[model samples]
Target: MATPHTIAVAGKGGVGKTTTCGMIIDYLCSKKTGPVLVVDADANSNLNEVLGVEVETSLGAIREEMAQAELKGTIPSGMTKADYADFKFSSAIVEEDEFDLLVMGRTQGKGCYCYVNGVLKSQVDKYAKNYSYIVMDNEAGLEHVARGTLPHVDTMLLISDCSRRGVQAAARIAEMIGEMELKPGKMGIIINRAPNGELDSGVKAEIGKHGLELLGVLPQDEAVYRCDCDGEPSSKLPQSNPVKQALKGIMQELGL
Candidate 1:
């Protein structure tokens, strides 16, 4: 089995992580470098929208069903718990021409996030080996890492907006990753939604304070904003789109 190289994107909410994930997938697909397994690990899932797809099911929903069934002692007659889980997990993936997407939707009325996260980890551990690349779009903060949702990350791209708080959030996440010993092969920071793709000195100082490698900055592109307004898939952004081009350059810089 080929070991899949996993790229997990983390950032504060509204920091453009989902759009960046979509662009990464698009670039990979354009280069014929799939099949990638795209994981929307955010509770408030929106990667499907960015990628121009609809999620009919999610791992959270599946986990909820399994929990209910287990309570009722219902294992679908002949199937064992493990087998049934594997079956349901297969259905949760949305197959696309370039890659497959798995969404980790909200765990409703949560008793604890432990169970669902474990299930997601199990599925990713099992399914990821079949792919050459696995790109995970994580929820805000470090909960996913703490839960072991992503067993390993080849590249951890910490994204932040132009705000000081956003950079602080990324720095905190990086600290968490280190403190938890979830060391990825490479880790870097991306400043998204930068004004004219330029960073202010204060922002640079904050980044320096955390010693985060500046992967690159994504310009505030009107095309991306327009697509969001008109409900267009960001993955369909034109090849000349500045945001897309900048992300491609960043990916190249990482030797992806």
Candidate 2:
């Protein structure tokens, strides 16, 4: 089977990373790019809300259950613990028409998570071959990257707002990628919520100083804000929405 094209989206909090990641997933699915796998690796885990999907379970929850299952005697007879874990992990995937979402939920109530994390990685690797693309919304801390958990990254999109601090945070992430030697096929920055889709001179200077590539800019669009306020999915935004259009163009430029 062919390997999936993996895309990792990362940024500091409040930079609209999840929203932009949702738009990318929606665009890929809408364009019929092929089956996509969406991974919400962010601990806060709101990618589903942006995509208008509901998730009842997560890998973290399954891990916790498995941690205590032996004591509780929940593993069915004739099923190995690994087999039971596989079954539970499969149930955590939230299947949608366009994509399947796997949320790496936050660890709870403290215990060594290494075993479950290994299982989750194995499951992701198994499922990855069945998709054309895998889009991940990562937390600002790059926990997956630090742990070397992602199967591989084809493209890394670092999201940032117009603020200097946001750009600096993105630059730091870029630096971490280099330090970790996780050389993705491509890496660039997408400046979101830019007023009129234009960057200030200082921000431009900062980008140049950090040597970060500016993939594209998404203008501040009230439509996106309105959708959030109305409890609607960002994918529900009209085709004319500037943010959507800008993301489409960015994806096209990347040959996605």
Candidate 3:
């Protein structure tokens, strides 16, 4: 199935999932790049940081207040579903060199973020229709997505590090999506920080066990770590970066 939306990356923390997504954004931004909308669904969104943009309002906050306002039946004047969605549109898209971003920050401890997530997903669907592509840096769990943040996605990239725990997290996300059976346009897996030389046959088997396609492996990039330490724009990663090259390879295989 041909999908207009390019991709979404989800996986365990510390797996370099965010960096991979940022690299994809950098690639897409550099090419013909009509407006591209990036939705940072992770509560701990540093996509803004990776890309070197300041993150402002988060979508979670907007929805929380919107729900409250709706309950009061006194929504701020000029706020209807249509108006609200528009406000969300205006609030979310952070303009940069060639890309736009919509951040959904970490949920407050109040409760599940499923409600806010649903609204975001809805708006994102509508938002994507207007752009050439949408890149979502998703939250850790696939629960929100399973609940319908994005029932149908173009491609869901499950990322994991070379650890058993990271691999387990990816497996769980895949299982969550599978249990929900929310058929996406396409979905796959990409293991990061793969060990070199001596094989951990146990770990390798665990990766192969998943039904999703294995896209590629990314060696831990010291450049990325250094950039983060200095708060640099990861999008500007030199072509010599190993992870950057691996990400490009993954994108090509996905036909982006």
User: Which ranges in model 1 have alpha carbons more than 4 Å from their true place?
Assistant: none
Please write out the lDDT profile of model 2 over residues 1-256, one tens digit for every residue: 7999999988898899999988999889989968999998877789999899999988998788887898899789999987897888999999998899999887787655565556667888989999999999888888778777766899999999998999999999999888885789999999999999888889888998999999989998898898889989987677778999999999999999
lDDT of each: 0.89, 0.88, 0.75
Candidate 3 TM-score, C-alpha based? 0.85
Q: What's the lDDT of the predicted structure labeled candidate 1?
A: 0.89
TM-score, per-candidate, Cα-based: 0.96, 0.96, 0.85
Error of 1 at 133 (Å): 0.6
Q: How close is candidate 2 to the true structure, as a TM-score?
A: 0.96
lDDT of 1 by residue, 1-256 (tens): 7898899998888899999999999998888975899998888899999899988999999888987899999878999999988898899999988999999887889357777788888889989888989999988865879866677999999999987888999999898898875789999999999999998889989999889999999999999999899999988989899999999999999998
Count clashes in each candidate, considering only residues at least 3 apart in sequence or on different chains: 0, 0, 2
> Higher lDDT: candidate 1 or 2?
1
Q: Which 10 consecutive residues of model 1 have the lowest summed lDDT? A: 141-150
